[model samples]
Target chain A: MKALRYLALSIAAVLFLVPFYLVVRNGLVSEAEISAASWTFLPSSVRWENFAELFSDPAVPLVRSMVNSLVVAVLQTLGQLLLCSLAGYGLARIPYRYSGVMFYFVVATLMIPAAVTFVPTFVVVSTLGWVSDLRGLVIPGLFSGFTAFLFRQYFLNFPRELEEAARIDGLGHWGTFWRVVVPNSRGFFAALGVIAFVTSWNQFLWPLVIAQDQESWTVQVALSTFLTAQSINVHELFLAAAVSITPLVIVFVAMQRWLVRGVAETGIKE
Target chain B: MSHARAFWLFVGPFAAGLLVFVYVPIGWSVLLSFFDARNTVTPVEFVGLRNYADMLTDGPFLRSLGTFSVFAAFIVPLTFVLALVLALLVSQISFMQAFFRSVFFLPTACSYVVASLVWKLSVFNGLRSGLANTVLSWFGADPVAWTVSTSPPWYWLVLVTLRLWLQLGFYMILFIAGLQRIPPVLYEAAALDGARSWQAFRFVTLPQLRTTSVAVLLLLLIGAYQAFDEFYNVLGTDRGYPPFARPPLIYLYYTALGSGGQDFGHGSAGAVILTVLIVGVTLLQGRVVRR
Candidate 1:
């Protein structure tokens, strides 16, 4: 029985790790080595120059896309932090007559498929001439219903003592929020930030449409163009994909627990 | 300021984004289904459901839906079974539980784009050097065209395997989380009642996981509908794609945004149809699960 269990795990682990090993191994080698009809498990030589080549390649603009990805990811994460936290504060704490309706409206956004909104949003953004601009990629995605819902749930269960003590000290709503709630919720912010940053960094379809120019292309968009445009550079493509996911893997490794817990917490109560 | 007015201050930016990005677009999509929306401007021609009528009967679009159904049919069960089995296996181990969980969950951090590249370029590459072909050669079988072959099901094999590898980890974690929430004393009591392992699992574990199963099922269905990145990266190269591998989004993409200018009306109608299908499935799942 123990052997059977071990065997199953070994198979699953091998299946999971083989592609990863291949991508990493093939990424560090020459293009010729990768495209050959047959190949070695390990390269005869390592080529750090492949990455330098990708960065220096004038046609693809790898470094610029990396910077673009960082901007989109970081900016989107910050925007969501501010907006969702504030909205969540209002909906969870401040008792307004219409807060229930407002909460429902926000929650309802989660159900709508993004495809349903793609054409009109594209038209609107194009009409505003946000095509080939960062605003088109970043602004449309800043506000997430899921993140807002997360913040709302988090704040709903928060103890009132902190807010009450702040109120007793003569602070108003905004003051209490800025001074108290934000500080207390730093861990949640970090967790959500990592997740949001990864999502924004990985965005492909929307960025593919709007980041029409080479200057504004995010990493994923640029990587896709590398594959489809004229010639396919097998090694470069593998290397670029490896490059794109490296940041996410780092963030996940460093904060895997919080990320997992955050996602699990998103589940609606039974 | 009034309390209500202050509330709006907190809600303003998010509400504005939601309106511009989601609500307005959805509203416009519904309207566009009725009119000839050839461009961003107001449609000059009011076709009165001609766009909907045309797309519904369109062979390629309808066939794309059918293809999606088959793809989902393969992936949903495959992922479900594999995830459950892995979850069960991992949860039984006392050592390195966290390590196993983290390794499995690692792929979930990778984008669908990267996953597709890994699967397509390295694993399922059409050349004899491709990993799949290399393995087949050991068995004395001819190198099969994994992505291009339409005779049998090499393309489906490529799609299904990549998707399962990418997603199985995520669902496994979710299932493990669900399983861990079930108390052990219940199983002990079942054992005392002369129940075997299989019987205990059937009555105790299965019943406990109902909510998780329903949630997982709904999420899987919706995600299967949105299978674009992997599909586009793997099979979609140029203007032409094999009919067998086309999903609804890819078909609609070409129909609406192809090089020879776009027909926005047809695209919006198709998008609306897909949205309705997703919403319908979720509602049906909710009803069934509730029962």
Candidate 2:
């Protein structure tokens, strides 16, 4: 029985990893090598020039795009963590008259697809002249309804006695929030942070709409432009893709523990 | 902190962003649906249901709706079954659970635009160089233009397969999480009571995952309705023209942004109707799922 389960899981793993394998394998093969045959499971030789040429592509500033992605992801995650935690803490802990209404207002945005707001958001950003700016990219994403919902649900189970004891010590709301609540909710905050970072890094549509020029483009957008350029350079394009997703894969691995906990928590609740 | 002041401070940022970025835009778009808003930034003249009326009579718009409904009908069930099967298999394993979970979930992190582009260029590249076609050729079948071809029989299958590959992992994670919540004691008890593996799953696992199943179904339905990036990136307006590959949301995007003269009013009307349908269906599903 144990051997059967192991064999089944190994097959599942291979199936899941096939796409990533294809990306890496294709990235190493030259144009001539790729077009010679339909598809090869292994490449005859690794073309390291693809990665070198990907960095040198003049149409896309790959390094700049990576910087833009990192800046946006970091800033957005930090802002969301603070704002969502505060709002979630209030709704979960504080006794406010309109708490339920406020919670509903936040959660309602989850249902409102981003596609519905695309046109107007473009108008608003254009009016502010924040197009091609990182602020435009990060600010709108900071207050995530999904993160707020997640944090609130997790905070609901937080022990009330701890906060009551802190209240007895005369710590004000801000003080209690910063020192007590946040310290205790580190796991939840870290979980939410990973999610925020991943979404911001991988986000395409909003960035594509706002960032008209290569200078402001995120990594994903830059990689996409490389793919759609008139001269189809599959080798370099695949290399760019591999490079673009490397940070995400690294982050996923580093935060695997928190991610699993977050998924388990979020899922069991719903 | 006082209730009123603290409440505002806590909820103010979220409310402002939500109202301006979400609710207000929706409301404004609904209002714009009644106007003859052109591409210019000037004030739009109110046409008072002309756009909606036009849509009612528009053959392509109606056809797009039918195409979207058919796509949703096929993709949602196919994805659900695949995800459920994968989840069941992964959950039964005693070790390597997290490794399998991460492998499946990693694709969800990939951008839809990139995925669609890869599918178009590399996977389904319509020539001898294409991956899918090459595999089919091994079976002595000719290569088919997966994206360009809009024949009724093939179009639906191609669209569903693309969507299924992109989406199955995310739902699979949800199912795996749902599976974990089922107590092991139930299974052990079932085994002692002479319940077989399939019987235990049917009796214990299925019922425990009822909420998750409902959530996944509703999410998939709403997601299918709103799908645009894949269709836009993979099958552009160039190929499979007129009525076929155009889902309703894609139609709205094309009318508003495509070269069809940029009638914002008509597009907004389409968006408004799509939003209403989604909201209504989601609410109905919510009630059903909760029950």
- Which prediction has the highest TM-score against the true structure? 1
Provide the global lDDT of candidate 2 against the true structure: 0.75
Candidate 1 chain A, run of 10 with poorest lDDT: A261-270
lDDT of each: 0.81, 0.75
Candidate 2: deviation at residue B143, Å? 1.8
lDDT value, residue A206 of candidate 2: 80
lDDT of 1 at A248: 88
Q: Alpha carbon lDDT of residue B56, candidate 2?
A: 76
The residue-by-residue lDDT of candidate 2 on B1-291, one tens digit each, is 786777677777767776766676677677778888788422379889899998879887888888778888898898899899888877777577777777877776677756765676677777786788888999999888877776635645556766777678778888887887788999899999999988997999899889889888877887787777676666653332344678876777667755556667887788777777777876787687667
Model 1, B20-124: lDDT tens per residue?
A: 888877777778778887744366589998998898886888988888899999999889888888899999987777777777778877777787777777888
What is the per-residue lDDT of model 2 for residues A1-270, given as tens digits with 9 covering 90 to 100?
A: 768767776786776676677778778888887666566767889888787777777765879989999999999989988877777877777778889898898887776677656665665566567888987888877767777788888778888788778889998666777878889988888876887788788777688777777789998777666554424477776667777788888888889777766655554346
What DockQ number belongs to candidate 2?
A: 0.48
| lDDT, residue A78, model 2 | 94
* Candidate 2 wrongly placed segments (more than 4 Å): A1-8, A264-269, B152-158, B237-243, B259-261
Structure candidate 1, residue pairs in collision: none
TM-score of chain A of each: 0.92, 0.91
Best by the DockQ measure: 1
